[model samples]
Target: MTAMQRLAGFVLVLGFCIIFLFKDGRSQGNLLTGKTVYVWDFATRDGEVNSLTGNFTEEFEEALIQTQQCIVIERRKHQRLFEQRQNEKGIMSLDEISNAEKESLKSLHTNIVVFGDIYDDTEAGQLRIGISVQSFEGEILTKTSVLMPRGKKLDAESRQMAMKELVQKLVSGKDPRPSSEPIVVEVENVRFELKSCKLSGGNLVCTVVITNQGEDRELHIYLPNTRIIDSDAEEYLVKAATIGASAGSAKLVSGVPVKAILTFGTVA
Candidate 1:
């Protein structure tokens, strides 16, 4: 049976839930830039893997290797690592990544991640392929979408052309934080703006900005109750927190914004 077929059966046995591990990795045209990348199996909109998606993903990885720019992690060789995140869809936005899964990726020693989907194109004889590339720091560096001949499956030359554009983009493009979309929360005028959440020195550090709109009432930030929650519904209690020169229990004034760094212990 094909990899897709086996994965389909495996997914069915697990109630059809598809999960993945993602971390930082990267590009093309250079002789093995020593950057690590992982290409996931492409899937249909309904989350089913098919020959078209499978072939395209495999071909793209081969193309990337040919350019001698990246070390593509063969998924078959790391099946257990891919199985680490056991209850997530195979494809999702970068923001949905959880802390535990990020830790898994770190363990995998990856630097770049590539995933894509196949959609019906506007034209009659083509399929729309949308691919996204993300860095280890949870940033979506760039994305590309192209139409391929329907049922033809791209030949070696066409696949090379496709990966060449993406590799060039990665090589030339500076990784950007497309995933950091201003995660803001408010509770009775205490606006908390999460600037970024990332792994640093084996701990999860989340930088947040707190705005006190309490009209000059001393904004009380009770550090003992703060927690860093992940997309997986798992909560990591803040082991250390700080604001400016203060290490813990920092207060804010009305209309003044104070930056707080909340640190959590390693999820592993």
Candidate 2:
């Protein structure tokens, strides 16, 4: 080949090599993997450091998080309303029922959503966390906004507690309620015994034994006020019994050992 042709070939190869190298670098620094993003602060002449709490930084982040959370809450409330419509079916207004009854129904149907708005103060030393909950319908339930003294924090855990409190308050129809401590219930050797029986009267005396298998856990046991769900006559006899004219008797047998004996007779 001629020298001039050889030189031209070398130049072309070099150009291609440079182009390939540039492309590889471009791919590595692509936004998908994350690249340094800079925002021009019109307030600060040319640009400002992208540090939390500067002026644009914390506000921008807080706005983004709030918008995202609002969208999520809106969607959740829509879905919950759909579910409530399905569950209510033919039922219209619950006005006729007792207030207690209406509350019980509401508890079964209502839905709550919790979220957090996180940002930093101007100094960027304190992180601000706003724990809040909303009804599916965009109504604010409970909000506890506090500035946590931390550089960064994950709001998930705090948000969860905030939600739990909100739900409990909403369900109870109370505001400014006391915070709830963690509660766990463990039932061990729960057994039933028949004390007495009268076939014709359909009355049987029965006792329920519930032993605290593990650590102490506060419990509220609802005796069979109505017929036990999906229970046969024999099973119901142990759980429910009617003595004479009285409907039933329930005894709270728990201070430490945690044992309860309920006896009642059912009229046949």
The C-alpha TM-scores of every prediction are 0.49, 0.20
lDDT (C-alpha) at residue 219 in model 2: 33
Q: Please write out the lDDT profile of model 1 over residues 88-123, one tens digit for every residue.
A: 444533345567666767788988777677776546
Candidate 2 residues 1-268, lDDT tens each?
3555334323322232233223322222111111111111111111122322233223332333332322212222234333533222121112212355334334544343333334456576765534333333333333344444453334445434433443333233333211242112222422222221112222332232334344433333334322221111213323433222233322223343322333333311
| Total backbone collisions for each predicted model | 7, 9
Per-residue lDDT of 123 in model 1: 64
Off by over 4 Å in 2: 1-110, 152-268
C-alpha lDDT of all candidate models, in order: 0.57, 0.31
Off by over 4 Å in 1: 1-33, 83-89, 93-104, 122-124, 154-160, 177-194, 197-254, 258-268
Candidate number of the best TM-score:
1
What is the lDDT for 102 in model 1? 66
TM-score of 1: 0.49
